[model samples]
Target: MTEGPDITFVLGTRPEIIKLAPVIRECEDRSLTRSIIHTGQHYDESLDLVFFDQLALPEPTHHLEVGSSTHGRQTGEMIIRIEEILRRERPDTLLVQGDTNSVLAGAIAASKLDIDLGHVEAGLRSDDRTMPEETNRVLTDHASDYLFAPTEQSRARLRSERIPDERIYVTGNTIVDAVEQNRTLAAQRSAVLAEYDLVPGRYCLLTAHRAETIDDEQRFGDLLTGVGRVASHLEREVVYPIHPRAAKSLEAFDLDVPDGIRIVEPQNYLDFLSLEDAASLVLTDSGGVQEEACILGVPSVTLRESTERPETIDVGANRLVGTDPAAIVEGADEMIDRDGEWTNPFGNGTAATQILDTITGAERREVSPK
Candidate 1:
């Protein structure tokens, strides 16, 4: 408990927060010197506490306050600030999760700084180079010292890319750990279902925040219209916890979010998880929600053209419905009334412990001669 690797976690955005939470808790439980640097990439700074506080995790040791901007500017600013933090903190390893600009910046900074880097949820590929996330994942995988892949499929992808097998550990994803642990916590403390007047299995939950879906006015309108039809067709309400960018897009595009869909402000992680657990269906463009929906035994429709988490679709837990009104409605109709009997392909929920044990038990890597 007194001694282990000193680690720094660099994360930005809600998905990173939710997924990395379990690993962070493990670090605390070990009394390891773990430092967190939150990039403040997509969150409102004031609401940052909602994630950390609700998760019962420590607030970040540092916040870079790099809010939304164009992709290039956002990522550039993050790298600059992240490098400053890593140089000063100089933790033995820097940990990053998933494929956000924050992850890319953190990976680049850590690798260049000569600090060992561990990437959780490594080797996932949507295989669409147009997506910034695809580029982030590929680059970060190459940069990482530890590639914690969630499934054999993911591990195979890394092998195909020639990433060293030794660097890869087929540790199950930490989201399994986070969701399994937090849903119980949500049951005890969260009143979200009651507060929203939602009866479990009678309503749909939606979260749409991706730029490719929402930033395009026509696509955004199509998504809303499709969800509206689903809600009206089934006489069930669709609850949307809108992201700031998507909300602004609605006003800027002068798009009408049709009836049968209730627009709500962004929810803290616990409240959102409670909603996910209770929903009859989930429609989302976010990658993390796709996994959460599968893990919670809720059927889902992914709003994007492709998914890195195809295991959800393969397991019969989800359908990949691109941004078309009819497709969305049809996917909803097919999934909404089904018995959700699909097996979870992610993990059995001990990923955080496995990842920490791997890092702790393995000796620090010596640098190759330049």
Candidate 2:
């Protein structure tokens, strides 16, 4: 009757929560002690609380309330708050997912406190350091005690960076786990398609909230123009569920969203999943969307020059079009025409099990004698 190890899961955004839901479920199923720390990086109820309800995830043990700010300020505030929690709770391990500021802060605080740190979705690289997420990914990978890389390609990236092979495990991306667990529920319960009057395979799902895309007025305008062209060409609507930050940027830039593009507010997880499942194609600057689209066997046009999830491209499920209007239109058409026959390279719906096993196994190995 040895005690199971205590683990803390740190997350701050909807994407992180979605991807980590299965892991949390696994912990509960196993009767393992687990705590969640919500950083409140995404503070809105629509973007945050609704996801927890949709995923049936438990309430977080602590919410840091670290809302949006400049990168330095946000990360710094998270580090301070998270470190305080770490000192008090002192869990055996801290697990973080994705490349948000919260991940970076969690890694730093855990490392500083000498706690074992596990980074899910580790070793992804866009190779574009200018992107803040890229920087976070690199730093967190180097600092992590366990690197749960999603693919062999990701593992290779870590090895190239000289991360010790023993510390890295190819556990596959947990997005697969999340999608498999929720898709059936989404289909059964979500009426978003009918509510929006969107016919399956007749609309494009567009999401652009990345700082590199939405924060730049020129880039934002170009993205909308490109999507508008594709919508007109296909005689389809481009359904955009705008992030709150992007909404403010739209007003700030006074960028007129073109015709054929229907703007909508952010959606709950099930609704968004339903929209993605039904869309003819997806066009976005979101890393999560690219992964979800690929998993759902949907075609996607990424609104970026580079992507961390390059496997989507290698498998013919995604094309990067950047912000060029013409390129965007061309890329969308090409993807729309391509067959979604490419295998999902992410994983089977067992990543959360693999992740939990890895964590507990590592702990056992540390305690056992040679």
User: In model 2, which runs have C-alpha deviations exceeding 4 angstroms?
Assistant: 362-370
Q: Cα RMSD (Å) between model 2 and the true structure?
A: 2.1
Q: Indicate the residue-level lDDT of 271 in model 1.
A: 87
Name the lDDT of candidate 2: 0.92
Clashing pairs in 2: none
User: Which digits, one per residue and each the tens of the lDDT, describe model 2 over residues 1-370?
Assistant: 1367789999999999999999999998988899999999997978986788778889999988889899999999999999999999999999999999999999999989868998999999999999999999999999988889999999999999988887888889999999999999999999998899989988889999999889899999999999999999888999999999899999999999999999998999999999999998999999999999999999999999999999999999999989999999899879887677899999888889998898887433342110
**TM per model?**
0.96, 0.97
lDDT of all predictions:
0.89, 0.92
lDDT of 1 by residue, 1-370 (tens): 4787889999987788889999999898888999999998876743455688778889899988898898899999999999998888788889999999999999999989878899999989998899999999999999998999999999999999988788888888899999989888888888988898889999999999888888899899999999999999889999999888889999999999889999998888888889999999999998899999999999999998999998999999999999899999999998887677888899999899888988887533443322
Task: Give the C-alpha miss distance for residue 273 in model 1, angstroms.
Answer: 0.8
Each candidate's number of clashing pairs is 0, 0
